[model samples]
Target: MRRWLVLVSVAAALAGGCSQAQDASSIETTARDFFGAVSDEDGQRACALLSSDARESLETGGDSCDEEITKLRLEGGEAGRPEIWGEQARVRMGSDTVFLTRWASAWRITAAGCERRVGEPYDCEVEG
Candidate 1:
């Protein structure tokens, strides 16, 4: 019985790790798709990936999200490995850092075009 319990524990641990890896991969994919849309000048598609608050941030002063998002010209190179904690994740790219949050069953970009600031939270061009 003890041996069986040990085996079950090992299996559970492995499953948890695999689940985290899958979450990371999904976050990375979302990040890549967002950047790709931006690169392709598909503002509509890019806006679709953003969280509601983030999207709303772009729509100000009578400017729509699709119009304002492309105007900023956010740049992000190849996506690096993502770090995820709970429902939040951060993906670092060659030129930018993106922050995401799990919304329902999917991940959405809460902030993009972020830069590190000394003694302060990340400064993002697009943030919720």
Candidate 2:
């Protein structure tokens, strides 16, 4: 019985590790797609990847989300490994950092074009 319990514990640990890896991969993919859309000038596609609140934030100035997103000229390059915490995640790219939240079954960008400031919260070009 003790051996069986030990085996089960190991299996559970492995499973959790796998799940974390999967989540990280998904987060990176989402971040990359957002950057790709921005680089390709596909405003509609990029906007679709944003969280609802983020989309609304872009439109708060009476400008369309698509138009505003494009105008920001957000820059990103190869995505680094994502740091995930429950439903929230942060991915750093070459020139920018993006924050995301898992909504439903997909990851959506909550903030993009972020830069770290000493002793302050990240300043983002687009945030909800």
Off by over 4 Å in 2: none
State candidate 2's TM-score: 0.95
- Quote each prediction's TM-score: 0.95, 0.95
Residue 69 lDDT (model 1)? 89
Model 2 clash number: 0
In order of listing, the candidates' clash counts read: 0, 0
Q: Could you tell me how far off, in angstroms, the CA of residue 24 lies in candidate 2 after the best superposition?
A: 1.2
Number of the top-ranking candidate, with lDDT as the measure: 1
Cα lDDT of candidate 1 equals 0.93
As a TM-score, model 1 comes out at 0.95
